[model samples]
Target: MEIKEAIALIHAEGLQAGTWADLGCGEGLFSVALAHLLPPGSTILAIDQQPVKPLPYSIPAGISVMRQQADFSLTNFQLPALQGIVMANSLHYITDKPNLIKRLAQSLTDDGTFIIVEYETTQANPWVPYPITLQALTELFREAGFTNTIKLGERNSVYRSGKMYAARISR
Candidate 1:
């Protein structure tokens, strides 16, 4: 699913973020949306290992989309406390999640929540490492310090794909 739809889903669940970071943001769709949807004086930090191109949409004054072309490794990131950290459709690409999640928890503000929206990879080859089960993902995050796990919704009933999931991790 697109980042806009993901952000829309977050909004439907009544999560209003004053400061949003599109962590591992590829092109900045959700970052742009957060900039637009958030209340006045809010900011959206669109960070990625690659720089996002100039968006088709204009960035509002309050939004600060920092295009960081640095790596996403935990050792590389020096995250300051942020309101919301979004891991949208990019979890599988991350090599080491446990350490990353711990860093994320530490980087979050007192009232912050980490949001992870990922694709439902079907169970297939056991020896392969591409797809991981929902339970596995939850356990990984829980082990990393996330407590609340919930299945948010299905992306759509197509190709028997797994449902979209979101978890809230308190700092």
Candidate 2:
């Protein structure tokens, strides 16, 4: 997706300038979008299992991104308490969503946000092995103790799999 589209998908009001993590960041597409909206002095930790390219866009001043190669689904991986987490096109790869969500919630500070961009479909292909729709996403996060959720935006998928939706969840 384009940077403007990415930003529109996950942007929300009242985002504080602080540390955020993009799990399964790939090449930091969504990370760069988040950086655009974040206030100066924010930092992003972009984690992916494979090597990632340097983010393509020019990031905002005072914002930094640290890339790390790691499996974000692994329970043993450590992260500092963060202001937010972005799981753009990444959560579906995991088979155990509940456990991963619970573990990730622990990595967030109180009032932390979780921004998710996902295909709103039940059918899964090789690329999205365990997909969850927006309804399922709300239930999943609620079950994991997240208290609030709001749909941010939606777009037709370029891959033609289905419509894509973005949601913000918070505790």
Candidate 3:
């Protein structure tokens, strides 16, 4: 999806002004988009295991973007209290899914939201280690203590010609 469209989808999920995180933020596409969408004084933690270089483009003033390199699978990795977290096309990489979800839940505030954009296929490949359908994702999040889960948007996956969905889960 386009960056503007993705930002709109996130906004539709009732995102509030506060700290947010873009876990496994590759190239900072959504991270930069979110920085633009969020209100002034909001902070976005753009994290990935790989080092992130400075953006070629400019970011507006009053929005803090902290890029970090850390393996999220390790329990030692720290995440600040967040109002929302976006895991766009990233969850499939982690071998320990439940543990990561639990840790993400612990990092969120009471009213925090977890937004996920993933493929809607059950097939797994080398690139997609743990492909999960939307139903499975909702059940996983539900088991992790999120009471509400909503579908924000969907689109055709260019790589596999399957479907990709964006979901919002809340405590």
Candidate 4:
């Protein structure tokens, strides 16, 4: 199926996360959006190795945005007890992808889900992320410890130009 079609399949199921997270959140778009995806009173933890950047300052009230400057590759720091969703967009920027995800997966509750969005290799942008195709999103999540994974379909990714793809993985 088309990449966008695949991602749409994932997002359409809707977000059931109570406490969500977006690891490696660069600009915070995916993190912010996922925060909005949750039911009211839900919290989202937006963790990044980079220092927090200036966002609109004005954000949704219920969402608890947590920023982490520590390197996620290190097996240090406290993982959150999350019963919601976690997302990763364009993870190719990660130097230690496996370790980084192992830490992230450790945070997932049995009821939680992990959403990943990456570009289809053929359509990946050459300037960003060394242009690695986001198609291996499933394998990456499996390596991270997601036992139950399903192709959630693709959508025209706002994350990039060509096509925005998405996948849903869970414990």
How high is the CA lDDT of each candidate model? 0.64, 0.92, 0.83, 0.62
**Number of backbone-clashing residue pairs for each candidate, in the order shown:** 0, 0, 0, 12
* Top lDDT model: 2
Give per-model TM-scores: 0.75, 0.97, 0.91, 0.70
TM-score of candidate 2 versus the correct structure, residues matched by position: 0.97
Which of candidates 2 and 4 is the stronger one according to TM-score? 2
| Clashes (candidate 3) | 0
lDDT of 2 by residue, 1-171 (tens): 889999998888888889999999998889999999899999999999998777778888899999999998877999998999999999999999999999999989888999999999999898899999999999999999897999999999999656999999998
Name the candidate that leads on TM-score.
2
Query: Model 1: which residue pairs collide?
Result: none
Q: RMSD in angstroms, all models? A: 3.7, 0.9, 1.7, 4.9
Ordered list by TM-score, greatest first: 2, 3, 1, 4
Q: What's the lDDT of the predicted structure labeled candidate 2?
A: 0.92
Alpha-carbon error at 16 in model 1, in Å? 5.1
- Please estimate how well model 1 matches the true structure, expressed as its whole-model Cα lDDT: 0.64
Off by over 4 Å in 1: 1-4, 12-18, 58-62, 122-129, 157-163
Q: Write the per-residue lDDT of candidate 1 for residues 1-171, one digit (tens) a residue.
A: 555675565453555556667787777766675666566666667778775677665777755666656565657677666777877656666657777777767777766766666656655433223454567778887786666666654455244455555554443
